[model samples]
Target: MEKDSGKHPLFFVTERLEFPPVEYTNEEGLLAVGGDLSPERLLLAYQSGIFPWFNEDSLILWWSPDPRMVLFPNKIKISKSMRKVLDSGQFRLTKNTRFDDVIDLCAQSPRKDQHGTWITQSMKKAYKRLHEIGMAKSYEVWEGSELVGGLYGIDLGHVFCGESMFSKVSNASKFAFIKLAQDLEKKNYKLIDCQVYTPHLESLGAEEMPRENFIKILNEKN
Candidate 1:
């Protein structure tokens, strides 16, 4: 039987675990296959510019769209207001601190005009494992003793692959992102993988690069 003919209607699993070419993904870059979110699978997926995203009860969906959105840490724009916040030093920033808490908060926090979340329970557990193994890291913004905002993602070689972020206070998420970019810059990290497009990310200096270009960069550094 043809490979596509035997695959699950909504998903597929590789017989020997190989990803389709990034270009073979649909217009949205949703390429083939569903596999467990084993650490090895997650790492391989990300390294190829694919990531798992799905709602509860659905099989894991992997994607790697064309015109990928990314941020070069040194290229992150700091607006006047954000610069003021940074200058004030009102919030304390820490790395890999309370990561599980940060992920939980992200899952619970509501997005404006959106019901539910994509950060399913299984994903949370998977990433938490990634964190424990030091492949994933969180950047948290704290107000006094409270954790107000943060983001998390895998750190593969020279890439900081952003998965999701949430803000509990105004500009909190932005601040945490700024700090992440700054720190990544210090570490000589190559890119902040935003995965998809968003006006908010554009305002912060993220731009689109073709998927092929992205994979080339990723592979070059790996």
Candidate 2:
């Protein structure tokens, strides 16, 4: 979606190693394009409330959407059915245990809103590197020894920026999400960064905050 910089977005060169002010983004929240996904760049992006989202066929696209969707760690809603699923002992949860598996499953999982996957090969590699460095985390839902569901994201100390999640069984992902929120609440995280909206997340108590406020809060905390 490239056009003249004045009318569209900034051209992000890898050697320059910096991003344009997110305020320069066009209406779609695309701030810049064409950067490498080195761990340094990725970490900085998350810290600045920016994230890379592009397909293999496109240049690396960066975004910082306004009215960001976030979930307070203490405000996660657990439906009665979810509670029943939890109480049933149908699954067990673990953290940072299988990030590669989780991300792979998420990439393979179909989405109703789009065709193909945004979690490209480069994205997966970058995130796995982040996981190796303790900056990325995953939550695994296990039914017996089988991994049925999970989610992965970058953890910026006080806020966890969720990337993607997938479930092999009904409510497995939801169970993992609720458990994650409960645990993070106990650990004093400010919120979970959902980035964009999804009705599924909204149903679980995620809400929108202004972009300026979201960045301010992200900066103020971690």
Candidate 3:
């Protein structure tokens, strides 16, 4: 929590692999920088209510934003149209079957206003490692022989920290999300961290809570 001039000092993680206290983050939620995405470091980051989110050319930036966006498992909203889509059985939902493909597609999918993705090659490899150890999971949507949509994230006991999702067709990702949420609810998961605001997530019942409250849940549940 050391201060530099009038601002908090950003910690440069090394072989020891540590982060400063989350309270040391600036107003933008940047907690630290320059940490390698080793599995241990990544787990520590998530368990501490922080996540890495920098573009390929930027230094590794860890963030713990105030007003964190999250969705309770049981609170996921499925509109009537979505319910029909679910019942029609047009898409098949599976968990952890094609994580590598899922993440690769997410990286390739374009965002409306964003330029380039934060899911860099290194980040994908790190998450793939996490998946190998069973700490990370993916929910994939398939239409016959083709993979269409999916999402992936870290599963910390009762919380799922969602990272990214992509869809090749309309409602594909939403179907994947709703299925995952329904499944998590059955398993008694407490929350799914959406990390930030999006109208899409808001429509599906995500709400922003203070960072302190989010951390409390992380500590208490996971």
All models, RMSD in angstroms: 2.4, 1.9, 1.5
Q: Estimate candidate 3's RMSD in Å.
A: 1.5
Best by lDDT: 3
**Rank order by lDDT, top first?**
3, 2, 1
TM-score of 2: 0.95
Model 3, CA-based lDDT: 0.91
lDDT of each: 0.86, 0.89, 0.91
Off by over 4 Å in 1: 5-11
- Return the top candidate by TM-score: 3
Q: On residues 184-219, what C-alpha lDDT tens digit does candidate 3 reach at each position? A: 999988899999999999999999999999999999
lDDT, candidate 2, 1-222, per-residue tens: 233548665656465567777787778888888879999989989999899999989999899888799999888988898888989999999998788999999999999979999999999999999999999999999999999999999999999999999999899899889988998899898989999998999999999999898888789753
Model 2 Cα shift for residue 167 (angstroms): 0.4
Candidate 3 runs further than 4 Å off? 1-6
RMSD of 1: 2.4
